[model samples]
Target: MSRSPEFVVKSPAMDIVIHSLSDVGPDQRRRLCEGARGIFWDTAEVKDFSSETEREGFIYKYFSYYMEREPELFFCAFSDHQVFGYICGVADTRQHQELYRCADHIPLFDDLYGEYPAHLHINLAAESRGKGLGGRLIEALEGALRTTGEAWGLHLVTSEGARNAGFYRKNGFTHEVCRGILPEEPRMLFMGKKL
Candidate 1:
């Protein structure tokens, strides 16, 4: 696995370090993964789970899928030995489409596979928001993909009209399209950026 150079961002009170998950030890990796799950559940826009089973089902689809399938693409932010945020993605959405459709039951984004081949998901702890860690995570993932030269661009799907849409826009993702998975589901905003 290619390792991203460890980056340390200094804040007024402490130092936050960004590390490629592939470079971390097993213990640290486990801790970061646990922390990431907590952050994902807490910060997720679709958190109106009625049961633990429902919550775990969403976690399996959105968070665990990437960590289990493409752990090399995961980047994490840590401060004082605690994980506060992470970014993870796939290099090719076409490959992800096949796996997701068969394994996770997620509908394919086939229409976008040709132009925007890569896609990402990011989440930050409540205390870590507004600190620019989200942007750093995106940059780290972009740098990793650029090294591989396998993707033309990146895309992400988020809740339509959500507050984070502006955040993605600030990071250079443009609204490409809006879609709904099922008749009962809310609309999803598809955003893309040339890498």
Candidate 2:
């Protein structure tokens, strides 16, 4: 593949750089992974984890697959060399399902996998929100996924009434393709956008 696009986003207050996991140094990758975990916990809609360990493990389970196997799909936004936001996804949902054996986890995901073969998770630090970093990260991931030509579109699952729901809708994920509630949580929304 050709070089990934440069994703340096600048604002009057600070300069933010977005990079796929594949492009960062080992140290930065490690920082990004840890930062991502922190951001996930802080922004997660589900807060039923029994302990911090379980919470961290949950983050690992969802993230390690893409970080290790599809680094290019994992994009991290950094400000002053610290990770503040990120967007990560699998290019093909089948690969993620096969690895996690979660075909039945999200309702209609299996049925809709052919058209929306990719899925993503995005999070931003509290201070980073409202500054357009999330949209930039989403665009970066979409560009990378489109270049691969392996997915027809990308999808994401967020809790219904999620604060980020409006953000996703604004970023072009308008289709409320599916909905289901995970155990102990409110309804979840499966939103998608065609590439």
Candidate 3:
């Protein structure tokens, strides 16, 4: 599906169109993830898992699951026919329950999603960074949430020092919790924003 191109208020040079992730093919998903990895690596949020093979594996699993099971909840931003950003959220109570069940095996899963608001994960490629695509993405997600009668507030967890905390805060998210290691590794920053 296509969307009307709209200019990002933060960067007039860029025009973005947001669409559901299901509308794209594997090749497009690969391109989107590649661009996303560039930004993730540059920010040093994901590095312990070395090699492109491992990285792609992680993305493929997560995104493939998202597309297959929750296509309507994921979105991709495009410009000139290329994916420059993406956002995905989980609003289904059943999905959230499954997350809690899976998290029972992981040490901190309980604290992360426990008593948390409905939310999603959003990311933009480095080339598309600092252009207000982030805010636009969240706005689009909020629109989707409104249609479903889900809560207006959304939450996210990201590793500290990712430099994305500020970006999220600027868009509307606020810090809710911070824990873990320091210097290089640390717990994620739990953030939330009210729609």
Best by lDDT: 1
Cα lDDT of model 3 overall? Answer: 0.62
How would you encode candidate 2's per-residue C-alpha lDDT over 116-160 as one tens digit per residue? 888898888998999989899999998887777778888888768
lDDT of 1 by residue, 1-195 (tens): 664667677779889888877888899989889888888878876768899988777777677878888887888899867888999889997776545654322343567868888889899998888988889888888888888888879988887788899989999998468777776877778889999
| lDDT (10s digit) by residue, model 3, range 104-140 | 2223434544444566767677777776778888877
Model 3 scores a TM of 0.68
lDDT of 2 at 19: 88
lDDT of 3 at 85: 76
Score each candidate by Cα lDDT: 0.81, 0.79, 0.62
**Pairs of residues at least 3 apart in sequence or in different chains that clash in candidate 3:** none
- Candidate 2 Cα outliers beyond 4 Å, as residue runs: 1-3, 46-48, 51-53, 98-104, 181-185
Q: In model 3, what is the error at residue 47, expressed in angstroms?
A: 5.1
Q: Pairing residues by index, what is the TM-score of model 1? A: 0.89
> Looking at candidate 1, what is the lDDT of residue 25?
89
How does residue 149 of candidate 1 score in lDDT?
Answer: 89
